[model samples]
Target: MSRLPLAALVAAFFVGLAWFVSARQALLLLVGVGLGSVLASTRFSFTTGWRRLILSRDPRSVIAQLTLLAAAAAISMPLLARFPTELNAALGPPSISLLVGAFVFGLTMQIADGCGSGTLYKAGLGVPLNMTILPLFALGSFIGSAQMDWWLALGNVNPIGLVQLYGPIEAFGITCLGLIVLALAALIWSGKKTPWFDRRLLIGAIALAVLMGLNLIIAGQPWGIVYGFGLWAAKIATASGFFNPSHNWFWSQPDNSQILSQFVLLDVTSITNIGVLAGALLVSAGKPPARAPRLTPTQWAAGLVAGFVMGYSSRLAFGCNVGAVFSGISTGSLHGWIWVPMAFCGTLIGVRLRRYLNFSG
Candidate 1:
């Protein structure tokens, strides 16, 4: 069948399922597909964006991310204020665990060459390394979630969300102002000659912001990745009788218990995550062929290790690029801001490590 026909069939399936299941989930799937399509089409990558800026003075990708952050904040704040019942912020406490996790996640993304979303979308696009990393990442998320209570006990303050603390107006102003300053600093540092923006990148950034905001509106929660990945692994482990949820701190919660008992598709994040993979595959099918990476076995091993660490650390730290950085900052959570700088520092170290490993791109 032609791509259009295939697309229609897929849409019909999801739509019918929506009728049988819930309208909100269908919307979440559509949003995920939209996010994946944009991510694939533009190759917008938080991992490379940060790495490039740190190592090569390339700010184009980083600028796209900042644009994304600004748009998400703008769209998110009003919705959060007006519809507090239906929406949730991506908030996490600022603590030693968060600082440590974000830094490790940052370094891992640089070494593994993909963030949470990046790994998922790229794996869907048939990138070998990402395909390998994705599974490891999931497993790590599962392990991390299982151990999160212990991590939290190390030292954690209550989460500080600007929306909850100061209301939408102040939150938006603070976030946008900070973003503008960061953007200007990036531009100045990248030098005067490099192109300030790419049309596709800018469009992707805005589209992503809109979609993520829609995710909050529809899912009754902000966008998240690690939680779903952990759920996936948890379900499998439970099914195999290798793990029990009855006593685990994270899994034993009432809400989580309910989710674990249901079909994965009924879960908002899993459905959305699947949609991202599907949408990426669809887009890749239509796009020109991509050159495969040239990587040695040692490099692959390094990436796998890094991927595992990325997932585990993300869970410990409360989220990855999408959860902690994108959703967190967009929702005016202090953890989001905290994650960025620490991850950047980790990226600095990762870049240096990459050279030593002879994994230069």
Candidate 2:
């Protein structure tokens, strides 16, 4: 089938998956696949293609991140107010070790061309090295999760009543969200140095935001791209003998594919990742190979090593820049804030080193 038609089929699949996940109710599989395909195709075209929005420097990405973070924070205010218990965990706020881990994560992500979700997403674009990183992410994540209990002990903070940054620190949450939205709008309107305003980008952003928001509401867990993908791979490698199941990696349990889209099923948003890469290919299929984004020899080595480090940190931190930082911050989690800045600062330094290192496309 053509990518267009296949995409339509996938969109339906995701809608069905979301529905099924939400209600534990089954809808026609064909319907799921079809609607999912359309939605995925739309997002891939608009978000990944038209925007030409690279993660590190794209205005849209930053805007979207800030917007989502603010929204999540705003929504959390009332929720915390209503159900005081849901406000914040008693776990220690970013410990010295977490700060250290975050710094390492920042450096590593810079070395690797992309963060956790970035790896899988780029893999869909058919990068050869990303294929390897996917598995490594799984292995590392398993180790991280297994040792998470120990880290939690180090995370010693009595999470205060919903972070009210203003008049009442609790009020700070929603107020910040509004200010963020305003700021992003201003930035988007300011200039056209790079391609940011596009229908495709808008579509993808809306779709992603909606999916993320809804997931938070029902699952009490955020919508994570990289960790989920890594976990998906973990399931596959475990079955394929790539990993030793006897090690007791915790989440390496049975594939409750009925709930969230498991790795093997090629379900909804997972297919969206597939759709994103495919959509990019379809657009540039006849064009030259993206001019092979130039990189220095050191940058190249950094990319490879950074790739592994990012994978490992995704495991230790329980998510990637997108999943842990973006999604986490959007949901008003403090850890999210910590991770994003650290990773971004790493990017600035990484860019400076790009010409010196063996950076690759």
Candidate 3:
């Protein structure tokens, strides 16, 4: 059978499964699939965008990211305002936990060569390292969540959402202004000016923004990735009896315990995660497969360690690049802004570590 038809058939099967599960969840799954396809086809990546700007003075991807943030904020803020009860912003506390976690997540993702969304979509494309990272990342996320309360106890504060503090329109304006200032700063830092965006990247950014906004509308929450991974691991551990959802502080919460008892498909994040994997696989089937890079044992060891750390730190920080930085900032949460510079600082360190570890640039 030709690849496209088979892919379509498989997608149809999943669509059917989603519908059987719940209409709302089905829409979320399709949105996730759409997200994966775009991530693969456009090669739109948060990790690559940040790395290029940091190391090579390339600003195309960075600008694209900022544009995405601005567009998402424009869409998300209004929806959040109109349907405050229905839609929840991606808010995390401005705490020491966030500071440490975001920084560690930044360093690890760079070393591991993908963030939450980056890892998922690439694994969907059947990238070997990312495929490896996915499982370990899940394991780490579970462990992190199990200990999340301990981390938060180190010092935490209430989450501050700009949309809540200022009205939605005012929050949107502030977000846009902040993004513009950051873009200008990035431009100055790069000192290697380029057009604001090429046709393709611009299209990709806009498409990503629109889909993310839709995700918020459909899911009744902002787009997220890591929570899904944690859920998968938690379910597995719970079934195996290695973990007890009722015993752990984080997992014992009313919402968490309820979601745990339900099937994976019923969880918004889990279904979307499944969709991401399937979507990436569909696109990858038609493309030339990417070859796995040769790596020394040391490099392999470093990568695995980095992957685990990224997963664990993400929980402590409340999200990864997409969950915390992209979705977080887009939704006008204070911690989302906090994640950016801290993660960037970690990126600086990670880039250096990559060289030392003998990994290819």
Ordered list by TM-score, greatest first: 3, 1, 2
Model 3 agreement with the true structure over 1-361: per-residue lDDT tens digits: 3468957776786678666877788788788888888888888888878888888887888898998898888889888888889999999998888999989998998889999988999998878889999999999998999998898888988999999899898999989888989999889888855555656777888998999998999888888888889999999999998987888999999999998899888888887787777778877886677666888988888998999999999999999988898889988899999999999999999988887887775
lDDT of 1 by residue, 4-84 (tens): 865886698588768988888888888888988889888999988887887778899888999999899999988899988
lDDT of 2 by residue, 1-361 (tens): 3456655655665476656553321222332222233333443321221122233335654554455455554554444445545433112255544565566666665555556555654554445555456666556655565555567567645322234333234455454755466455546654557554555545555555555444444334444545445556656666788766445434434542332234344343344344444444444344444343655555455566666666666655545665565455554456655655565555556554543464542
* lDDT (Cα) of model 2: 0.49
lDDT of 1: 0.88
Whole-model lDDT per candidate:
0.88, 0.49, 0.87
What TM-score does candidate 1 get on C-alpha atoms? 0.96
The deviation in Å at residue 33 for candidate 3 is 1.0
At residue 199, candidate 3 shows an lDDT of 69
Tell me the TM-score of model 2. Answer: 0.63
Alpha-carbon runs more than 4 Å astray in model 1: 5-9, 286-289
What clash pairs does model 1 have? none
How far out, in Å, is residue 185 in model 3? Answer: 1.3
TM-score, every prediction: 0.96, 0.63, 0.96
